[model samples]
Target chain A: MQSENSSVNTEAKKIQTSKVPPSEGFREAFLLHLADTTLILTQRNGAWCGHGPILEQDIAITNITLDLIGQSRNFYQYAAKLINESSLAPSPVEKAGDEATEDSLAYLRTEREFKNLLLVEQENGDWAQTIVRQFLFSVYQYFLFEQLQNSKDDQLAAIAAKSLKEVTYHVSWSADWVIRLGDGTDESNERMQKAIAALWPYTGEMFMQADYEQGIISEIHLLKDRWIEKVKTVFEEATLAIPENIFMQSGGKNGVHTEKLGHILAEMQYLQRTNLGAKW
Target chain B: MQNINTDFKTNPINNKASQVPPEERFREAVFSLLEQVPDPEVPVLSILDLGIVRDVKVIDDKVEIIITPTYSGCPAMDAISMDIRFKLIEYGYKNIKITQVLTPVWTTDWMTENGKKKLLEYGIAPPKRSTNNEDEMPKCPQCKSANTKLLSQFGSTACKALYQCNDCKEPFDYFKCH
Candidate 1:
C-alpha cells in the first residue's frame, strides 16, 4: 500500500500545474455525476453496517455499499485524471487540479458543488425506503450503463462494462425485495407503497438531461421509457401500481441539492475536515 | 534470495532463447512470481487465481504488471498491490511498476482449475453454475451435495455468497460467479 503507484495514494498530488483541454469539462462533470451518486448512496448504506435487521441482510447491504464504493472510486479516479489533465471548468478552472485526489474531491466538495441525484441523497428512512430507493436507482443504472458500455470513450466504456455486472445483481436484489415486501404482508405492502410515493418524484431527474450530459449522453430521453417499463414490470409482480401525474423535482445534477445532502456531507466530511490531509 | 538481483527478472535458462521470445519467457517468470503472491483477502488464492492481474509487460528497465479490479470497491486491491510489491522486493526486483486497467472485465471463469480445487479444500465451495441455468445454488463444499440453499447473496467478502448445505448443515462461503 505504501507504493507510490498505490491506487489509494497516486490521486493525491500537488495543485494544478498543467494545461487542460477545453472539451473535457462536460466529460469531467459526467464522471463526477456518476461518482458522487454512488459515493453518497454508499455513505447512506454504510450507516447500516451494524444495524441490519438480520445478520445476512446486513452483510448484503454492506457488501452492496462496498461494491458501490468501488464503482465510485473508479469514476472518481477517471474524473480526477481528467481534472488533473485539464481544469475541466472553462470559467473557474480554479480547482480540479493535481491535488483533486478522489479523497479530496469526495470529502472537500460542498453540497452545491455535488452533482449527484437527489434520489440517492434522500434519507434512508427505513429498510423499505432503502429498498424502494435501490430498486428505482438500480433499474435506471442498469439501463444507463447498458448504453454506456458502448460509449465512444474507452475509459467510460471500460467502467460501464465492468460495473454493469454488479449493477445487474443490485437490480435483481432490490427488485426481489420490492416484490417480496410489496406482495407480502398488509403492513409491508403499505410501507412499500408509501416509500414509492415519497421517492418517485425524485426519479424523473435521472431521465432528465443535465447540461454536461447533452453531447455525451445524447439519448437520455429514450432511457426513460425503458426505465418505466422495468419499474412497471417489478411493480406489477409486487402488486403495486404506477402513480400518475406526479411533479418531478429536478436540480441535483445541476449542483442544486436537497438539504439532506448538506447533513450527509457534514457527517461524511467531518473526519477529513477535522484533520486536514490525514491518511491512514 | 535478497542477495540475488531481483531487478533482473529474466530466467537464467531463458537468457539466450532459442525458441520463445525473451519477453514471453520473462512474462512466464513474472506470472510464476505472481502465483506466489497470495490474494490478501482470500489467502487460499493468488492474484492470478482471482483473475485480477490482467497482463505483465517489460519496458526499458521496469516490469509493468497490469491488474483489473474484481469488484467495484474491493478493498483488497490496495493490499494485493502491496503484497505484489513486497514479493517483488523480496525477490530483489526494484524497477517494478503496477498499473490497474478495466477492460474485458474479469470473471470467475479465469480462476485456474487448481485454484478452484484449492478453494474446495479450503472449506469454501468453488464458483459453480448448472447447465441451462436450472439452479443457481452451489454444491456443498463439504458434502458435495447439490441440495444447498442460499443463506445470503453476500458473504463475509464482496466476492462470495453464503450458502448452507441442507445435508451437512454447514454454512459455507461460495466463491460466487461474477
Candidate 2:
C-alpha cells in the first residue's frame, strides 16, 4: 500500500493537471460557496441531532444536515478539481514552492478563507427559526441551481443539474414546514414570523452580486439576476413578505465571514489537522 | 415482464470460465443486470442514468455496487439500496454488496439524454444545463409549454420540484436539474 504522504502527493499532482475550462472558475467558486454554507449549517443542525423539540422533526433536521454534508462533499471535490485546472500549474521555481493539493487546501484553509453566506452561520435560534432559515436558504439555492443547470461549463452545468434535483426537494420540504409552522398555531405562527423577521436582514447577502459575480455573468453568461426573480416568486408563494430593507449584510464571497465560522473550522479540521496524515 | 429467473439458464457456477473466476463474471452480470433497474422514484430512469452508480467491484466472491446518494439525507437511499440488492438476488446472485459513496457527489448532468426524455414523458420536466441561458428552459412535459412557473423548490420526492404549466394550467412535478 502507498504511504499517506505519497497518496497525498499523487492526489495533489492529479489535481494540478486536471482539465477544467477557464470560464468555469466562477462555477467552482459557486460550488465552494454552496459547500461552505452547507458545511457550516450542517454543523449547526448537528447540534440538534438528538435534541429536537419533537421526534419527527429531530429526524427531519438530522436528515437535512446529512444531506447538506453529502452535497458539500461533492461540491468540494468538484471545486478541488476546478482549482487544480485553474491554479495548479507547476511553479516556475521547481525547488521553491509547489501548488497545494485539493485535500491539503481543504484541510489547511483558515476561517478567513471560507466563503459562506452569513445566514447559515447564525445560531439555530429555535425550531421555528431553524425551519424558516432552511426555507429561505433552500429557496435561494433552488433558484441558483436551477439557473446553473444551463451553465456553459459542462462540468458545472452537470453538477448544478444533479444538485438542482436534490435542492428542489430540500426547498419543498422546507417550504412545507414553513407553511405549517407559520400558519399552525397562534404561538407557532408568531414564533415563525419572528424567525423570519430576525433572519430577513441576512437574506440580502445571497442576492448581492460582487465583482466575481459580475465577471461570471458578463463573461460566462451565468445568470445571477434570474435567480433573484425565482427566489422572490417562491417567497411570495410561501406567504412570506420580502423585506424592503436594502441594507443587506455581505462579505462571504470575498472571504469575509461571520465570527461563528472560526469555531466551525476548528471543530471540522480538528481530526485531520491534529493527526497529520493519520488514517484509520 | 418475465420473472428474472426464468429468463436466463442457471449455468453451473464452475462451468463458465476457469481462467477468469466465475465471481468476476457474476459481478459483471450483476452490474449489467442492475444497469436495467430503473430508479424507483423515477421509474423511466435507471440509477446509471443519474450517474449515481460509481463503482462495481467483486471482492471475496461478493459483488459490491457503490452508489452516491443524490441528497445526503434523501429518504429514498435506503429503498434504492434495498431494491438493488433485491433485483440482483432475484437474478440468482445471492451474495451482493451495496456501498454508498458520499464523495465526488452525484449530479443531474449525469442523467442520460434517454433518461431525460423518459422524465419528460413521465410528466416531470427534465433539468436543463446549469447555465440558465433562456435557450435551455425545459418545456413542461405534459403540455410541451415553455410558459411554466416554478411552484415550489421541493417536490414529492427529494429530487424533484413542483411546477405549473401556464399553457395547460396544470401543476406538475419537475425533476430538478441536479
Candidate 3:
C-alpha cells in the first residue's frame, strides 16, 4: 500500500528514489518549488500585459512579469541541469532522452507534477484583487530572497542576491497599490478587502516546510514573523487590519494543487504539448 | 579577417609567442573580438562594456566565452550568444562555445566607465552610483537638470526606469542601478 499523502517528507522521498538519488531529488525538488512559484505567478501577471487598466500601469506590470520570468528561467535552468546530471535511473531519464530543459519543465509537466504555491494560481479577479495578491506574495518573497542570499549553494545564493533587488521593487510597488486602492473610493476599498479575504487562506502554505526544502531553505517560521511585521505596517498604513486565525491551506510543495492549476496548465501548456519543441 | 591579423599558426594574438600559452592567446584574441559585439538592446555598449562577459578559456582549440545574464530572462542573451558565435567563426575560429555562468550574478556596477559614457551620449541617462535609492533621481540626460521625478520604476526595459526632467518636461529612460 502507498503511504499517506499528507506526509510529504518520507513518502515523497521514498517514491522519488526509484528514479533519482535521494539527495538529488531533494535538491531538484527544492529548485522546482522556487522556479514553479515564480513561473506560475508570472503567467498570472503576464495576462495583464495588453489588458491592464492604464497604459503606464500596464507597462509596469508587464515589466515586473518580465523580471519574474527571468528569475524563473534561472531556477529552471539550474533544475534542468541538476536533473540531467543526477537521474540514476536511465530508463525514466531516457523518457525524454535524459534532456530536461527549462522549456520542458515549464511547458510539459502535469498539474500534480508542478510544485508552485496555491497563492499564485488564484484567479486575478479584479484590479484590486490582483494588487492584493501581488502585495501579499511580494512581501513574503522579499524576506525569502533576503534569507536565500546566504544559501550554502552558490548558484541559489547568486540567484537570490540578483532576485532580491527585483523583489524589492515588486514589494514597494504592490504595497503602494494596496494602500492606494485600500484607501481609495468606497468600491475600490470594498473590493480590496474582499480580495484579501479570498486570498489570505493561501498565504499560510508558503511557510510550511516541504521535505525536499529541509536544509535547502530552512527557518520558514522565522521568515513568517518578519513577513507579517512588514505586511502589518503596510496594511495599517492602508487602513486595513491583518485578519486573525483563518484556516490555512497547504500541500502545494507536495504537488497537491487546486483545480485552478489544471486549468492554468491546460492554457499555458497547450502550445508546447501540441507542437512539442516548436521554436521561433 | 583583417590585414593586421596573422594566421592562428602564425600567432595572430598580438605578437606574443610561445612565452604565452596558446589558450591564453586565444582568450585574449576572443576578448578583443568580443569587444566589437554590441549589446543588441543598447547598441552603444558591447558585451565587454556591459560586463556580462565573465571569463574566456580555450580548450583544445575550442574558444569558450563565459557570460552571466544581466537579467534571468533577458531576451538579448540569445542574440548576444549568436553574435558572439558569428564573430568568432568569422574570425577563423572554427570550434567556438559560449557558456553562461550564474554563481556571481551580473550587476550594473560591473559596467565599464566608457560604457556609462556611451550610454549618456546615446540619450539614456547612465546608471547612478551603485545605490538602490528610490528617492534619489538621476540627472536628466537631455537637459542635464538635477530636478527629475521618477515616473515609473519599471521602464521600457528591465534594466531601466522611466523618469522625467522637471525643467525640460521631457521623459527619459534611466539605466537602473541593478
Candidate with the greatest TM-score versus the true structure:
1
Steric collisions counted per model: 6, 24, 1
DockQ rank order? 1, 3, 2
TM-score ranking, best first: 1, 3, 2
Q: What is every candidate's C-alpha DockQ against the true complex, given to 2 decimals?
A: 0.46, 0.16, 0.44
Output the lDDT of residue A191, model 3. 87
- State the weakest 10-residue window (summed lDDT) of model 3 chain A: A12-21
TM-score of chain A taken by itself, candidate 3: 0.89
Which structure among the candidates has the greatest DockQ?
Answer: 1
For model 3, residues A1-280, the per-residue Cα lDDT tens digits are 1344675574333211122223647888888889999999999999998998988789889888888998998898888888878744432224876488888889888888899999999999999889999989988888888877877677878898888888888898899899998888888888888999999999999888888876666556667888898988988888876778999999888899989999999999899889988898
Model 2: residues with Cα > 4 Å off, grouped in runs: A1-28, A85-105, A215-240, B1-178
lDDT of 2 at B81: 82
lDDT of 2 by residue, A76-174 (tens): 766765665675343222122544343454566677767788899887998889887887787777766666555566566666665665666567677
Give lDDT tens digits, candidate 2, residues B41-92: 7778888887788888865555668887777556567778878877876766
